[model samples]
Target: MVRQILPISALLLGSALLLFAGGMNVLILPMRGTFEGFSAASLGLLGSGWAVGYVLGCVFMARLVARVGHIRSFSVMAAFAAIAVLLSLLILTPWAWVPLRALSGFCFAGAAMIVESWLGERAEPQSRGRIFGIYTMVNLAASTAGQLVLTLGDTTGIVFFVLPAIFYCLALVPTAISSSASPRPLARVSLDLRALWRNSPVAVFAVFCIGISNGAFGTLSAVYANEVGLHLTAVALFASLPVLAGALSQVPIGLVSDRMDRRLVLVLVAVLALVADLAFIFLRPDGRLENLVMASVFGAAIYAMYPIIIAHANDHAAEGSAIQVSGGLLMVFGLGSIAGPMAAGYSMAAFGQTGLFVTSAVAHVLIILFGAIRMSMRAPVHEAEKAAFVTVPQGRMATPETHVLAASPEEAEEIIAAEEDRLAEEGTGPAHEAAAAATAAVAAATERPPRVSEEEP
Candidate 1:
């Protein structure tokens, strides 16, 4: 692991820089948009625009990496991200920034995927859990640091925009100079809705709902903080401190989830989120210290819910399908993310700062309802059969390399087939041989043909 770390340290450092930029931009952008006379609806549009590009990038950018390779793709995305930030600094118009923001999202997601892919490639199974945990910590810290960095700049000035560009440009340096071999080829992953629903309907639905709640709040939380009479520093802290807390809280939360029924843990988390949202809507705390505590509690509970949902889903996923399960849930979360901001943004537009909490509360209520519904039904999957839920680096943006684990169904079938073949070849059992042959036949029929049949028979 130490040897692995030495080679990829530069790559990881660059990833941290990229995460910092992503974090800083998230903190400042809506405020910047509002400063520039953009409406809440337009700001919501900007937020959703990023998710649109982000999810699209997650789906397709791996192919770009597969074609061009990781190093080249990383460079391309870094340059693109830096350019997008610069463009935003130059134009400073909602109309211009909207497309640039989308571009930025695309580049961020692409670069992050590259870094994670590198880490994943370097990691052994024995050390993967630790490596991913450290990666998540590093990223969470970077994002929090980025948000806090805004205290050094004037929110009303153009420096916030220029600063994130500087960080993004800085992000290009580490990976470009490192001589590590490019990561494995990128692959696409798709959710099998039927299997996922069969495994756990609540997990699937909860992931989507969690995505909506988190996405909406993530995009607009800082803006909402500002409207609620928090100063710039407090607003940044208000927005970031909770995520930091949430990341920290995951340890105990995960430990608890590991020991007991995950659904029960999820119910508690949803209830916590519901309480926080209600407080935000009604209590409207005044003291700075109190507000900090409130935000941290809210952040910890809401942000922490996704992992539980993921864990619960993995608890029942078919063997060797952890990647696909995570990917499908991620896609579902991304869809919810796009919806979250639109709903919260519109809510903010109609009802002001309080509306954000209202949107969040409603999401929590739905989640709670879903959890209840699932409790009535028997769990379809067991704890012993649970797939390992590995944590990727947080706020690192998804990239092609980072996403390779979640193979498309066809790809997964091929993988499952290959493993079966390897296992059968060494054993030499008639039953195993027959099973492999049958699986191969099924996979072959479903599998894409090696070559296109362009000529007519």
Candidate 2:
């Protein structure tokens, strides 16, 4: 394992650096804005701008990489991102920061695509799964670490902003200086909404709801924390604990989804999320511990939904169309993301801090009602034919390349073959189907507890 990872350790480091910077950047902005007396509505707009840019980036950035090459494109994007952070620090008004946040999101998606593209080509087939697993872990840890960094000092300060900007630039040194040659043009997002709906209407509808619920919380958790009077330390915990809980929960959640109809699991999880939503709204946990507990439960249930939705969609996908299904759902999720923060912001504006969950609660109610009805309407996909579930590191932003790296081994071979077909067809066919076969999803699919074996790192 050590020998295999050593060759591409630099790429892993670069990914971690990027996440580290991004982790701080995402949380700090809302916290600082709240401190500066920015309204919940403005903060929600910030999330909207980011979601819009992220969707655009995932859809379009691959083309930019094709035209200008990975290294150059990545460097330019990173430079722009760092510049945007500094610019945001200088221009504190909500109006100016919105576009700047969008720019950061665009650059972040492009840069992440470039990094994942590099990892995709460089990884040998023998080690692809393990390498990707490590990459996922490193990035997730970095993101969590970045959020935790807030506990060390006042989160609403210039120093935190400066620190993230520095980390963003530092992220480039590994890949920029590596000897590995650039790979093929990054995977493009080819969205076939009608086809996706045809494949799984439940996935289409559920992901948009997932997008809204998760997107609102992802953007407004800090805002909610501040309004509820948690100290900065508690606020940091509020932000980070949900992610960790979600990561741990996906393993068991994936296993359960694999055993029975995933739609059933989807409904169950939605029910769980709805419960959390109500808990936040009514229980009104004033104590930091109660708030943290609810946040973790909320995150766990909400974050686990995407994997099941994607897996369920691919179960019905035509041969070699996993990428399209996953990509399409991702795009739909992005759209939901665009709406989530804005709607949640308005809700909080009208109601109170708990209004963040009110928006999420509505989404869950739709999910539950729709999921239960869908299950009764359609027979479950046979477990044998279903694409294996893979837990994704996807809460903040997930791009096409991220999906590519997340594909399972069986799916990986299919993707490479599909890539060949894509080339043979003169680039006129559907783009690569980089179906996400991520870490926890695979383990759950196989119904095995995690062990340091050949398949896992």
Against the reference, the lDDT scores of all candidates come to 0.73, 0.83
In model 1, the Cα lDDT at residue 239 comes to 80
Q: Which ten residues in a row have the lowest lDDT in candidate 2?
A: 432-441
Q: List the residue pairs that clash in candidate 1.
A: 113-399
lDDT of 2 by residue, 1-457 (tens): 8898888888888889989999999998999898888899999999999999888999888777655667888888889989999999999999988899999889888888888877876666567677777888888899999988988987756888899899999988997897755665667777778888888999999999999998898899988998889998888889888888887788899999888999999999999999999999988999998999999999899988998998899889887778767888899999999999999999999998888999999999999999999988999988888787878876486788777777765555555555444444443322221111222223333343322223222
Off by over 4 Å in 1: 1-4, 380-382, 389-457
Per-residue accuracy of model 1 over 181-239 as CA lDDT, tens digit each:
55543445676788889878888898888877887877887778777787888988888
TM-score, prediction 2: 0.91
- Model 2 pairs whose backbones collide: 389-441, 390-441, 391-441, 406-437, 407-437, 408-437
Candidate number achieving the greatest TM-score relative to the actual structure: 2
Instruction: Give residue 17's error in model 1 in angstroms.
Output: 1.1
Worst 10 residues of 1 by lDDT: 448-457
